[model samples]
Target: MRSNIYIGSKRRLSIIALGLIIFLFTTGIAHAQTVDGNKYQLTLAEAIRFAKSQNKLVQVATLEESAAKEDRKDAYNAALPAITANGSYQRFSQLTLFTDGLSHSTTGPRKPSANGAALGIDALFNIYSGGKQRALQDEQQSRVHLARLNTLDQSGSIALQTAHQYLELVRLNDLQKLILDQLNRAQTRLNNINSLYKNQKVTKSDVLRAEVVLSNVQLSLQENENDLTITNRKLDVLLNIPDSVRIAPVDSAGMPKPAIDSLLPFIESAGVTAYSVQKIKENIELQKARVKGVESSNKPSIGFYTAYGLNYPNYLFFPPVNQAYAIGFVGLKAQYSISSLYHNKSKVAAAKLRERELEVQQQANNDNVRTEASSYYIKYTEALTRIAVNERSVEQAQVNYRIVNTKYLNQLSLLTDLLDADNLYQESRFNMIRAQTNALNIYYNILYISGNL
Candidate 1:
């Protein structure tokens, strides 16, 4: 019974000790998270959503898009028939009218002769107008298409900026961590160096060098912390939030990028080419341009009209007089300006120039986009290589630092060796961090170009 009680007590003690360790580790982690820093953790999707809804550039793009939509709607509605209703009432004072040939020998003043009210409804169905309306409609549609494309472009630009800034913030944070770790190692080395100097085993110069290195690292850390603050403020501004509110970089770990071939094809095909996204813009303009050509060449537009009216002798909306007069008439209206004054020629020339300009702009955009795609692809590859190389470097530096520290303590290596290894490890770790961010940024940039943003 006594042995069993001892075993139970030991087990209970082990459990209590394990609980304390878990509690302490959890508390430390929580405390570290609360440490003074500007990073407010945000995921990529979350940041994108915030920017889309709140970013200033995005707001402008959205407003312009809405206006373009309204213009397009108005243009389309112009294609339908139009109707108007009009009403009028009029009374004439007593007068002798000479046009009626009643002015001769009129001894007494003529009484008021005509008073009437009339209501009419008229509608115009554009039978034909040299394709003018169609051309106008098409032009408006093209403008809308251009506006939409511009909106996409704006979004892409802003997304790329936001994504790049996010990555930079992450790199800054990693560098801060790397510097802190190096400072700790430097402090440890300083302690050892002081001990050896006290025993006359090491020179004072070694201690001073270590202190300088430590101080420099401390300064770098402080600068990086400041940069982190700046990044957070800028990000908040991009999100249109209060600058005091902090935002951290999104984690870029394990993000999948689109295939380069697929992305390249998309960039290549996005201009005046067939199956291009910008084809809508081009086609709408082309349609408008052709109709304008026809309209200008036709030179004459004719409209036919007829109307009938009945009038009573009273000026009330409800005619009071019983007597009524009825009249009906029909007529044809036409317009043709005899012109060799280069107006038609100029219209045609301008239309052709505009079409060519749209084509040229699209071509230039194609080239620009293709060049950007290739550059970003190359950048992604380089960043990935850098991350790999830097990861190995960090590991090697860690091993070197550990070995040299042990040797220095045992008096087998110099203090300079230990410091060098320590500095190398810290720099390599920060480089790795920066490379990780660069890789992620390039991936997001590619997505923006590909219209995935």
Candidate 2:
């Protein structure tokens, strides 16, 4: 009875130890999962927003826009009156006159005033410049618009690039999962072959083949891991994040998939709304304004000018005077560049030529955008079709693999048949994933071309 009681206590202790180990293992796994979940996760929209704000190209474009705004301000300031102040002081030395040569007088020397001081203010208001100032203002305004359009273009380009890399990473992750699953199956197959070989049911060659296949799957997994790391780093650069941090996309399923009811709207929108097209249109306006400015040089410029000042030892009088005197004058000023009459013709012609060139460029850009939009629309539709086809292929390949695997296990088929079916199965799955990602990518491309992204 004592021996039975001791055995019961020992069994109870063993049960408690087992329970403790299980609890600790589960807790550790949960903790690891929590840590993984805490890692930085980003959605596509968040990434695009971050990139637009932080990307070097976008920042450069924004700076250019700011500079253009400053230029506009300068142009406006040119139309305002210009005022200037001046002040000066000087000590005069004694002056001697040669009275003996002209007057034949014995007076030795005469001194002018001891010192002189002057304070003055001048103002010039441009009342007319043959419309040159107004034209320049218009040109600067167009430049501001162009710069802003360039910034928008840069932002859109970066967003598209970010989406590409982000989707590539997501695709790689999905492929990794598939490859890992295949690796396990390969390992199981190798083990099964080894077991059969030990029973003398399979040849040594069969075992070697299974090992090679398993090795190949492992190699694929390694290659995929390398690609994942590289893609993650690229995305980090785009996001302006630290290279050491790895980013995982939160979800790609939320990407827009607009219906393809009509392609005409996209094409039309791209021709008018795309940043490139808008920039060209602004450039044409800028060139026209420049032409007007060049032509204005041939005409006269008229302005109002005024000056007022106080002077000591005033030199305006014939004899030197010691007392301070106030002086003031106001008049209208006109200027005409005789050389510009001949020289400005060539400049105006050149400016007009540039304007025409921009108009031609605008036409070309419109055509290109329309073509691009139409092409992407077709590709987007094609990708949807391919997705359906690949889905069916995956189903067929999965069924074929199961049949071949069962046949090999029952010793009714060669190992090569099983391996081929397995490879086909993996390829089909890979194709399916590629098709899905390609569809999403094409959708984004369409949006980008249409300036809607």
Indicate the TM-score of model 1: 0.76
Model 2: which residue pairs collide?
Answer: none
Q: Rate the local accuracy (lDDT) of all candidates.
A: 0.67, 0.83
Off by over 4 Å in 2: 1-38, 98-111, 252-256, 262-264
Candidate 1 C-alpha lDDT tens digits along 1-453? 999998997776556434433433554422212112333456665566556656888789888989988987997788675666667886755564454475463333333344656766555555566667777677776777777777776777777787777777767766776678777877887887899889998888988997897788789878988998898878777766656556654465435544545556645543333223464455647555574845555566666565566665543434354465555555566776567245576666666776677667667667776677678878887887887798789889899888988998889998778777876777777677777777788778767766666
User: What global local distance difference test value does model 2 have?
Assistant: 0.83
Listed in order, each prediction's TM-score against the native is 0.76, 0.88
In model 2, state the lDDT of residue 100.
57
Writing each residue's lDDT as its tens digit, candidate 2 over 229-331 gives 9999898788665565566676553244567765457766898988788888988999889898899999999999999998886677778765788888999
Model 1, position 167: C-alpha lDDT score = 72
Error of 1 at 266 (Å): 5.6
Candidate 2: worst-modelled 10 consecutive residues by lDDT: 29-38
Positional deviation of residue 414's Cα in model 2 after best superposition, in angstroms: 1.1
Q: Which prediction has the highest lDDT against the true structure?
A: 2
